[model samples]
Target chain A: MPRQIRRWGPPLLLISPSLIIIGVFVYGLIAININTSMTDIHTAAQATGRKPSEFVGLVNYTDLLASPAFQHSLRNLVLYTVVFLVGTMVMGFVWAWLLDRPARGEGIFRSVYLFPMAVSFIASGVVWRWLLNSNQGENASGLNRLFQILGVPFLQNNWWNNVNYGIAAIAIPAIWQLSGYVMALFLAGFRGIPEELREAGRIDGASEWKLYRYVLFPQLSPVALSAVVIIGHMSLKAFDLIMSISKPANYQTKVPAVDMYVFKSAFNYADAAAVGVILLVIVAILIVPYLVHTARAEKS
Target chain B: MRRMAAVAAVAAVTLGLAACSSGGDDEATSTSTGTEAGSGGDVEVFTWWAAGSEKLGLDALVGVFETQHPEYTFVNGAVAGGAGSAAKDLLQSRLQANDPPDTFQAHAGKELTDYIDAGQLEDVSALYDDYDLTDVFPPTLLDLLTVDGMIYSIPSNIHRSNMVWANPAVLTEAGLDPAATYDSIEAWFPALDAVQATGKTALSVATTWTQVNLLETILMSDLGPESYNGLWDGTTDWSSTEVTAALTDFEKLMSYTNTDRDGLDWPEATQLVIDGGAAFNVMGDWAVAAFEEQDKVAGTDYIYFPVPGSADLFGFLADSFTLPVGAPNPDGAKAWLDTVGSLEGQTAFNQAKGSIPARTDADPADFSEYQQSAIKAYAQDTIVPSLAHGAAASITVLTAISDATSKFTTGASDLATYQSELAAAAGS
Candidate 1:
């Protein structure tokens, strides 16, 4: 081999297996899925030997967009994303703020707050499903029962079972399962801020609130952005959490991922592929700008 | 760790070689044994009966299979889901991958047609003759199982979909008779009003599928069984006044249902009736199993009757097993099917599942009173297929209808819009 080729061959060979893995599983499958989405292959006639194939470009997308179920799912996704993102970030920041102060049993309280993060979303969903059981009156149990026992019947709402705000209720378990992780992220960001920055702010007659507002909060913007991106994608691709929490045919908590699952379960390959593509677009819409900004920031 | 890595490298290569060699053996075995040979003496029966009475029925059936074929071991590949959604999802993926089980549970009629059309299932038609099932099994059910003049599957049990279960105590509490049957759905409004007056939920409906269940029953109540059956075969018109009236009746019925019905499943709704939180629950006979789980006495605690004006109709969904074409063991699969269709097997399974046996001559003494009534209904009543459970319509049509109904129940779509959507779904 020539010297230049020989020098690069070993390094290239070292990464080839990983590159091939990503090539087939990531890009290759994505290409196949996109092609399938462009076709009219569904579970019934197409699955049977009847209609072999028909390439109907963008028809599935058009039909899906016009679909009432898909539109409702989109609404649910938007509502869930807003509630989950805001709930997790606010609760995480507040917990981090509380824990940032020095105390004797600070480690215990921190671990207590972070304990929920250790549980999987599926497990959290199962436990929360019971607590938020919507049955009222004579059959009421779970949180409603507790509310009744506490003589605070006003606090007992139907929770996630309410059609108007049920999708937002799905965000509760998502926020509970993830807020601790976000708190950990914020805690690390808080600890990473230089001690002299806070001292300099104090010397300049800045209050404790002003010090955090000017010095700490500005530095945590990147942390907050990363949290948003992470939770945003999770909320976008929310399937197992939603499915595990409610009945599959529930209209209120119908996210795009669950809609994709309904199509997939019926073997509507083309429509399922369309839902997948839409989700990819949503996640891309959410994350691509953040990625570009970070890339540019890193270069600068 | 290095040794383990070397072992893994060797294992990966072996697995790769094994996969490459499997296709050749499949063809070879097809000529001899008529199926791709399964590894060892294993017969994996795939199903969605992974919990509760369904699992109980499955286990009892598998026990019979194991007893009949002592030399072969059985693999109960039961995925968990009440409506078989998870199991069907898994089955489709395995079918696409060409890695099918020895036998898999599938709904009879249009649901099994998907596999039959795909050439994924074997013709077990001859087995019906061998087992003397030609005379014993109901001809309508056999016809439903047949496609292109070949029977592709064997039915184990038949479940009725149009039954209204009532808590007898709740009925009395609402100042209604336990044995009273409304001549028509429109007449139930008075009883519902009475229940509502008593401060209990008048009706208990749950989820979108349950709404679809009610819709199907209302459609039957309005169109009658004959015209309703015609809906699936392109004979009945979707835009007819009968369908319009059915939708109107279904809408009126929905007003009596608990507002929190969206989050509950069929079982939970049944529990509402049982707990006296609701006066009436419209569901499949599977609710009997749930009531039995709570040790509720059928005659005293709860009672079930046919949906109004559909007393002579059995809205049926049969759970059957198909012999996948590339199943590892054709012989083992045949043995399993024999157990599935046999008198002893159906008795054992249905006795637990709360559904009646598929056989015309199944012993009524082997079943509970509720199941015995269902068996009598199956024997005498005209049998129509369930739309929501992949029997009357194609799975695609059923899914679309489900989506439309889901939207409709939430008041996101109007009756006329849903009717049009239903037409589109049927035509597609």
Candidate 2:
């Protein structure tokens, strides 16, 4: 105990600077945002003078909850999150499994699969925006054009412009970009599983499919869970991808992050802050429980 | 590969910094970057036209303005955005921070209300008399800029919003005459059908603000000038069948638009019309400059007419400048304003801007055939303010209306619901 006490001071000193920085930049800003949201400040109020906003308790939150725009955005965020997470996970696992085998050019295929990860989401978004454009016939030069060349007119849907599948369409580019990273995660997890486990399954007369279904998949759940956490938070705070890919005021693709931006520009400071807080609460709902379970699992 | 991702991350930070660099919340207006405002050494003229002919137009004006005042430096601090959204945001932040530029561009009417109510703009009513601008500018245009018996901004130029640019050859191919004009909104249906039969998208529009342009034109055609003007204040009832009819026509208009429009901007939409991929585009007269820049001759490569049934009305919006309150150099700002609202400034700026000079006295020969027609139309037709471009309504109201229009254009909302939502927006 005495030795542990003596060792603590240097470690404490080592972490203090980052702690202070995070405290000021992240937590301090968050608190200020929350305080700002609990008021009646708006564009008109702010323009007259940046006054100390009169406290209005939960009025901003109440108004946001009642607003159709906010409700629509929340719905989009949920839909976008589900499709992105599942799409990335499935694509990642498939890519990992294909490349995990002993094959000639495995290194080349692996590099090719990982290339999209190198490009930023915004960069991918701009390119995909054109490729997925809903223009028809000669004007269409992207995915729709390929469909035309393939003689499969049925495959030529309005990609992202179709609002019913708009959120899902956004997920396609996202999955394309992040699935390679997810594959890296799964590949690591696959490598971490000792040969003995597979050998035991093989000794039991289990085929590769059976081994994958029962043994391999169950063991990768932890890695999958971690990937979900990473991707989940990303989808919650999604701004740049949507901004680059879609129209700014496109209600079909609007999410809370975009709502925050639109509101901020209009000088509806209180509403903007409310959107920020709602985003925080959602991220917390998704991540806090996963973090707690992971901590407990590590301890156990 | 890692370097590329790092660059993307940096790009995101650069955008954030640009937003914050609206001069921050320090409340310090003075900077050493330009010549001191108090010294009469520099008069920073702010605008959103940092590139293309818009910039060229501003440079032309600056060239003229500089010749008039050799003692002062004219800093062209133009931030660029598709519309004025980016510049507006930057200007808003700077104004809030109390670091007003000596002069800034704004839409003349309701758009300047935020700055005025916030006490960011100085009343330049006296400059109107001193410069004899009351004689040069039309009373209708002057009336739009006046708020509570005081004029807040000096309009440099006027651009009619309800202009329809067409590819003459494409229309001729469709068996429609190159110079044809529809007498009503419903008349466009047969025309668009003919264009579509020729295997072209009948109409072209861009993503956000362009939808606003289309919506405003549709409203004016259906509602006429007096009722259309009533749509802004509490004078017209949005729940009336007239608005419902306008929304219906708006929906019909969207049916003819290019499906890939959400991926394009206004210029691209104009190019679509020019390239014969689309037959028609409802845009501001600025599309003339864009077409001219591409070496497309007017009346042959392309033709423009006011949107069907709206020829009797000049749906106008003005790009004007304001002498911001607490300007570092009031004399320099007054000089700039005098130049902006003056005959020489308006003529030079408008000739390059593809807009008609706000002053009626500008010689028509100095403008293009298209712009001369616009000037003649401005003189003969009844003037109505534009809702889409922030002339008829406040930004808050305009934003709400835009949201409804955007949603409706995307087929996210039906006509009746959009009508009610618009009513709620205007009433708010």
Candidate 3:
């Protein structure tokens, strides 16, 4: 064998299994979901050999578009995505910057920030629900308990009813769970910058702000993009937190995943599938371009 | 390297073939033995009761089944999603993969109808015949389990869905009679409201299926059972004034429920009534099992009645198990089904489940007072087909109602919109 070919062959062979695993588990499932969405197959129908394999030509899509629940969920998903993306990225970057500075108990602070992410979403959701329970009026769950203990009665009202503040209430858990991941990503990106680059900028009369704006910010793009993509995906598929917060009776907490579940249970699998397909499409539209670009960048 | 690649490809092909063969064997093993193979002779029964006293009732049932079939064990596939959302989908995917449990719980009627039609269910009609189920089983229970005149499942018990469970203490505190007919239940709503004013929940409607159940009760009681049954199997105008009135009344009733009720499961709502946390809980007869767990005696601690002030029509459905086509132990499954369906089995299972036996011959004395009352309604022919919600329509139709109801109760949608959406779903 030629030397160049011989050198790369073993590495390629070694990685093949992992590639196959990814192909079957990740990409394959996505393809299956997409294909199923094109048909009208539901749990019952699928059970009965009545699975609609023939193409219905976007009937499901049209139905989805006309669904008010779907529309509301889409709006919620977009709002969640934007809030989650902005909150995590900005807060995470800020925390990352703060942690990057020399300080006491940096390790403890880092661990504190990262601890929320370490816990399972299920556990986090339960804890958050207990903390956010509306019954805890002035002394009940969430900020109320904290406020009431401080003799601040005004802070104890139903936070869920305040449309203006409810999104923020819901967002708190998302940020709590996600900012750490973002911070970690940003930390890695920040640390990648050579100390000499900062020193050179400093020696050239660049202030701290200016050094970051031009040098640091641009270098963090890839990391921020990565964070945005991941957090956005997580936010889009967010189920547990919203469910924990929003009782079915409260019009405030209804999200797409909850609705998907209700629809699925009610045996409205078509509607559920439609919701799922729309979610999948939304995520793909959000992330695929970045993924392709990243892959191309890596290849080059 | 090319040779190695070729060898690796061969290995892949071989392993793939092996996987396919193993899967085929696994399926054969499961399918051939039928229902006998429940989670490795440890029948992993999947249910939605993980809270409070339903858990106790389940424990009792498990104990009975275990004692009856010691060779078979039980695995708790008890998932905790209210309304059986997660577990049902999981069951569906498993059944689709032809890896269904030897036995799993199902609501008798259209829920199992799809499985029956798919030939995924073993008929077990002969088991019913052998069990001499006619004596103990009522025609209504049989009606729910039979599709195309063939019984596809064996119901463990009958749950009278129209029962309005009331706290006698709360009722007396409000100076209201607990034994009032369905029509009287609404009159008692003011009394319930009084209870609510006392800083307790007046009505424990969980604002999901419970709300739907309450609505069904109103329809059955006020609109008359004939018209209610017409809504399901017969032609009735859904937009009629009766439905409109029933829905409006239901809306008003919902106003009395706990603001946090939407997140509450039915059992939690029942717990409220049992704990004197709520005045009334309109749930199924099986709900008595919850109160019983607190050692509260029926007809004493709580008063059960049909939707009060309305007709005496009883709305009922059955909880049944279907033997999946590929159950690993079909013989054991058949044995399980035969044992469960027999007059003796029905008596034993129903007694534990706080449900009336599916068979007509199962001693009425074997049930609790609430169940005895339900059986009386059935005996008097007051028990109508429950198709209005549970038994009335196919699962597809029931789901449509549930979804529309969920949205409607949440105030995300309203009545006219609900009706139209329901119509669309039914037509779909």
Candidate 4:
């Protein structure tokens, strides 16, 4: 036992700092959050340690599940996720395909496309708030003004202000902000592909379109999966963008994260924590599969 | 020899990191202790008046605090946001951690009840007696401040939330009289229709809270001040025909508002009125400062009035300061509260804030024309709490109502659903 301790002690000590930090900050907090979610604590006094909170079992969770606001937020999340995922992937793939070949000012175009990623979601949301202004007629502004100037007034429509699918419109800005990042990922994937594969496809009498459809597209699956996961988790956790554009109370753009914020600000900690737990479970469901797949891939 | 050296290196790095973290903790402790050691200490007054006209109001108030309490250093702990939402969140966390600030701003009605019930605020009834504020503040205002004969906060200023700001130019273009007073909200609808006929928005509303503000005024109009106040206390039924009529009026008024109402803030909606894009906006008296910022004269450029049927009623919300139960500097906090409730402090703050002083004795000559009218009206008017401004309800109820209103305004929910949701919120 002493010999084993001597052999393992140095390495264990080396990693102990990081392990301890993550244990306390990450897992410990999550455990506390879950515990809080199951309690009946909703006041600042209880939250701050002035008053004791009672264990209420799943009451908060049941309440949230029955809430119309929470239900609507979940629906909004599904719509936002679908649009954000599809929009970013398609736009990113197209941009990468266009830029795959060597061209004049390639560096400038690449820089211009990636520049938006440098701005924070809050900052971009502020600009996009104006850009997506839904007012028409004499009060036409933002994108509506642009469409009018371009003589494409038919395209003028209420962007995020449209009640039926306003959350989908919010995804437009998310796509605008993140599609460039997806493009960067796809571009790297394209560049990493061996030229010999294309040469081999050419020798097989494959057309350029056919060559990409069979060879290039298959090779880019990993990149696409990664982009989806990254953007998927972001959309699930989206708060600042929606807040900066619309408000937390706005049903048009509100999601579970925004609802969590509203609950938190209202000092309904149990409800907020319940919403948080739901969001965490959702993100975990999306991520755990990818993590397992990656683990399997590494083992092989 | 090599293995020993590696082990030594790892131990040294870990120890260094531990030392660095401990060093940070020590520095933090030392600074905090240093601040607490002084005779007067630091009085950190937490508020959301961090920018624009609100910031100026706070600054003027701070100037009075400094002059009144020269021994203590005034720490401006202002967090900028609309309606103190962001600041309140931070304040809650601090209160939870038992690290309350010396004093914080709170709205003056049922909103303070939350803090009082939580045992987070100190009862300032003694301060009221000591300062002789009972005689100075209006009885109505004092009654609103009191809960079970105990007051937790001192009123700084009063903001009338039922005021209608109309652009004279827009009304003239729409061929309607801007200065014309309507007996009820229904009486105002014809004026709204006339404005809409001219291809302009009749009522310029913004976001969820402003809609609630409008709803409160309409309720006050339809149900009368007594019934409207009863709605908060469970004395009036939310499902009653009177409330249904109020909701119908609210829905009708919504039709005349700007299409992109949710996309704009209160200032932007108010700006539409100033720029002749809309006929009128129902906002708090703070909009007067906003108009003055744009160099627009009241009465000439824009006219003010009570929202039609709510005349002779002051739908009000007051900004007040509280001494937390476990404040770091209680003596300094009481001094700050004394300054906040003082005649001089109210004058300086209200003049800059474009709000009327909570003190009835404040000279009207020190205020603008709009404030002068408000002061006169406030004396004679039946006082009612403003719902949107955190006076009539707790934050949780307000948030729930806001969520329902947002859905209703966005057409996600109908009036019936909204009424049920509001009833459910109140019941909760």
Top-lDDT candidate index:
4
Best by TM-score: 4
TM-score of chain A of each: 0.96, 0.93, 0.83, 0.96
TM-score of each: 0.91, 0.91, 0.84, 0.94
DockQ of 1: 0.39
True contacts kept of each: 0.42, 0.51, 0.25, 0.62
lDDT of 2 by residue, B1-428 (tens): 95685446545554555456555643345443233455456788889989888888898899788877777778888998647778888988887667788899998899887777777888889999999989888888888888999999888889899999999888888999887778999988998999988889899999878898898998999999888888876798999988888888888889888888887889989999888889999999888888988899988898888999998999989888889876777778888887887778888888887888988899999988998899899988999998878899988788788788778877888888899999998986
User: For each candidate, what is the lDDT?
Assistant: 0.84, 0.85, 0.70, 0.88
Off by over 4 Å in 3: A1-12, A46-53, A135-169, A190-212, A243-277, A295-300, B1-86, B168-182, B297-302, B367-369, B385-389
Model 2 spans with C-alpha error above 4 angstroms: A1-16, A47-53, A137-139, A200-210, A213-215, A297-300, B1-37, B326-330
**Cand. 3 Cα-lDDT:** 0.70
lDDT string, candidate 1, A1-300, tens digits: 689769977876787676555655576568779999999888555854456888999999999999766887898899999999999999999989988988678889788878988888888888888888776776678889999999988888878766668888889888888888899999999999989999999999999889988899999999999999999998899888788778676776788888888888777889989999999999999999999999999999
> For model 4 chain A, where is the 10-residue window of minimal lDDT?
A19-28
Interface DockQ of each model: 0.39, 0.33, 0.35, 0.44
Question: Higher-DockQ candidate among 1 and 3?
Answer: 1
Best by DockQ: 4
Q: lDDT order of candidates, best first?
A: 4, 2, 1, 3
User: What number of backbone clashes does candidate 4 have, counting pairs of residues 3 or more apart or in separate chains?
Assistant: 1
What DockQ number belongs to candidate 4? 0.44
